[model samples]
Target chain A: GAGVSQSPSNKVTEKGKDVELRCDPISGHTALYWYRQSLGQGLEFLIYFQGNSAPDKSGLPSDRFSAERTGGSVSTLTIQRTQQEDSAVYLCASSPRQYQETQYFGPGTRLLVL
Target chain B: GESVGLHLPTLSVQEGDNSIINCAYSNSASDYFIWYKQESGKGPQFIIDIRSNMDKRQGQRVTVLLNKTVKHLSLQIAATQPGDSAVYFCAETAPLNAGNMLTFGGGTRLMVKP
Candidate 1:
């Protein structure tokens, strides 16, 4: 079985540019989540999707950050205007259910804004 | 501080010695806890998890102890090795009604010396 995977393992862009990171969660998983990892920042919850219900957008960093999960499987996180402070690893995780289950993570996409 | 933090930012131990990493979470409603490990260039990997109902849970060689009385959680690694050198993070899920939001700790860097 293939584990969770993300495209463009690494990405680099200039400041003020737009960037999108993709995540493919495990098949049959009903819950998916996005998180960011920065130096000394630990892991910050970004957004979460469960089945086809409304997504939880509370953890999004700011207005510039947004994410959408289509078909309850693949998710795309977009940044309107990239900033140097946005340079970090974008991680995606999924689980069979959101009821006290463990989350399996993808390799993550490292984004660097210059 | 109102965030999850570690007593020590870093811990150094011999390859065969046991290791203990501590975390303090301020949220009294945090009941579900999980321990994750992140390598230098990889995404975080889930090691183990424990609910507030139980005070202890054990994995292959790792153990998680939750002290709800004091809002403290700790991860213990037995027979530590170089392979275990990485940043360990403690994450807690909010009480039942808060959805899937997880608050993560600052993390503790574990250095295993040969």
Candidate 2:
């Protein structure tokens, strides 16, 4: 079966620019999550979406970070006015259902803000 | 805020030998734990998971052990191989009522020598 997939494996942009990272979760998956991994750091939870429930944005570092899942499938993570500190790998994961322990991850999109 | 952390930043082991990675989480309320492996340029891949009710679980060549008393978790790989070299992370999550977000540890870089 096809696993999670992300677009733009690598992205280099200037500071203050905006970038959108896409994620396609596996078919039938109802839970989706977005995470950020800084160089040599652990994964940081960003946002989560489950079915039609309200998304969890508590982990988002700032208001510039936001994500939306349309039709309960694909998700897009948008970072407005990107900053140098936002230069990191944005990863997406999904599970079969909410509260599922195992999450399948995508290849990720590496973003570099100059 | 409570967080998960790894006991060691790096671990080196000879191929064919057993390898063990340790983690500690501060949230005692967390009931679910998972182990993930990430290569140099990829997102995390789920290896195995264990729930609070059970102390251990095994999958293929990987085994996950949980100690609720000490808030400790460990991943043991049998006959470690070069392909197993990667950054291993342990994550913990509360129950559905509390929250579904996973708190990941810093991660342990496993270096396998053939």
Q: What is the lDDT of residue B87 in candidate 1?
A: 94
Model 2's lDDT to the true fold? 0.92
Per residue, candidate 2 scores C-alpha lDDT tens digits across A1-114 of: 599999999999999999999999999999999999999999998999998778988889999999999999999999999999999999999998878458889999999999
Instruction: Identify the runs in model 2 with alpha carbons over 4 angstroms from their true place.
Output: B96-99
Docking class of 1: medium
Tell me, what's the RMSD of every candidate? 1.5, 1.3
- Tell me the TM-score of model 1: 0.95
Candidate 1, chain B, TM-score (2 decimals):
0.94
Candidate 1 regions off by >4 Å?
A: B96-98
* Per-residue lDDT over B1-114 for candidate 2, one digit per residue giving the tens place of the 0 to 100 score: 889999999999999999999999988889999999999999998899988999999999999999999999999999999999999999999874233788899999999998
Candidate 1: tens digits of C-alpha lDDT, residues A1-114: 578999789999999999999999999999999999886669888889999988888888899999999988899999989999999999999989896778888999999999
Against the reference, the lDDT scores of all candidates come to: 0.89, 0.92
